[model samples]
Target: MNSIWVITKRELSSFFDSLTAYILLTVFLGLSGFFTWLYGSDIFFIGQATLQPFFSIAMWTLFFFIPALTMRMLAEEKRSGTIELLLTKSVNDWQVILGKFSACLALIAIALLLTLPYYITLSFIGPVDHGAVWTGYFGMLLMSMAYISIGLFASSITNNQIVAFLLALFVSVFFLIIFDVLAGNFTGSMGQFFNFLSISTHYESISRGVIDSKDLIYFLSISFFGLMLAETSLSKRNIVE
Candidate 1:
């Protein structure tokens, strides 16, 4: 088998083999659904078709869920020492990193798609801007991928899944919320840096139908930096051993 596909198959199988995958999907969707109905009042409050509430809620949900899902990616393998077995195989570091990344990316894509009924419901009940809805969803996916990549790197660093989860959660929370919050505390160009550094700011901006190339690059760059860091960790495992 090709190295990339081999690693991908391994990751996909692990996700499905565990009940947590189903649990995550159910919890994420169910929680988001409940919040949507509760907050949006099922669109009664807005009285128009808008997914702002949905994305607003989902941003919070993904913050926690991504860590939970990604905590075990490499951390558990290191815990069991099976990472050595995989390293002995034909796969290169990129293949391993990309494969693990692709599997989580696929999972996020599936979970995002499952929320389509909400969009359909909005479209049915009122005049909804489907373009904006789709754009928001796309922005959410891109942002989620970046978050997941951070979690993946965290997982790669340790043999303890809890540590990985906390590390990933901290990083995500910083980028997702703290950076934006700091914008208020900083001044001028420095504050602008925080706003630019704020994943939430960029994500919400793009989610609101203003998709900029810079925003896309921000998302992609974080994702790349994370994967590269994971590979770097894997490379250093020998020294630590």
Candidate 2:
């Protein structure tokens, strides 16, 4: 537990020291704000007292940004041969993985927190669907967790950050887009299966203020599976060395 917190803080400090955190926060806020207030189907255009536009735009923005954020979590460590040094310490593989995951998730949560002004502004504009807005934020966090784990897994399998970034994006695309498309093209059990595999399905469900157990399970399953894979990969590497 203390080990995990140490790694989390170390990773976070590195993010800030390198200016990655600032850049990510700026870009995320810029893009989300642009589409939510100034671009097509913006709040003014829809005239709705909801942050759906922001949520929708954020879904896509985070989809890309998360890979970039996580690309170096383990890949750079492996590339620089620091992973072995760290693993030789008191912490185990799972602690390291969890710490990196927590750091990335915390950064994302901060990004989302900065957007609270959007919710506050909506409240002033009209009657906002407070329940739906909160749920939407919750859904974003879950979705981010799933992707962060996937990204960490990708980072673990290779020592190249670019390869990790691309791999993570490729795997995430299946859950974010491909499965949704396949679900639309199929029917019966096939469609149902694809729908169940689609992250969008669960995210949309939660964003609509319907927090089903199944939705929670879908995100958790993906996150846990990805983290397990990452831990396994790291363990194998340690054994090889």
RMSD of 2: 0.8
lDDT (tens digit, per residue) of candidate 2 on 1-241: 9999999999999999998999999999999999999999999999999898998999999999999999999999999999989999999999999999999999999999999999999899999888999999999999999999999999999999999999999999999999999999999999999999999899888998989999999999999999999999999964786
The estimated TM-scores of all candidates read: 0.95, 0.98
Candidate 2 residue pairs in backbone clash: none
Off by over 4 Å in 1: 40-42
The sequence of per-residue lDDT tens digits that candidate 1 reaches over residues 1-241 is: 3787777777877788988779889999998988787754545676667888888888899889988888988899889988888888887777888888888878888899999999988888878877788889999888888988999999999989999999999998889889999998999999999999999888888888888998999999999899899999989966878
Whole-model lDDT values for every prediction: 0.87, 0.96
Angstrom error of the Cα, residue 187, model 1: value is 2.0
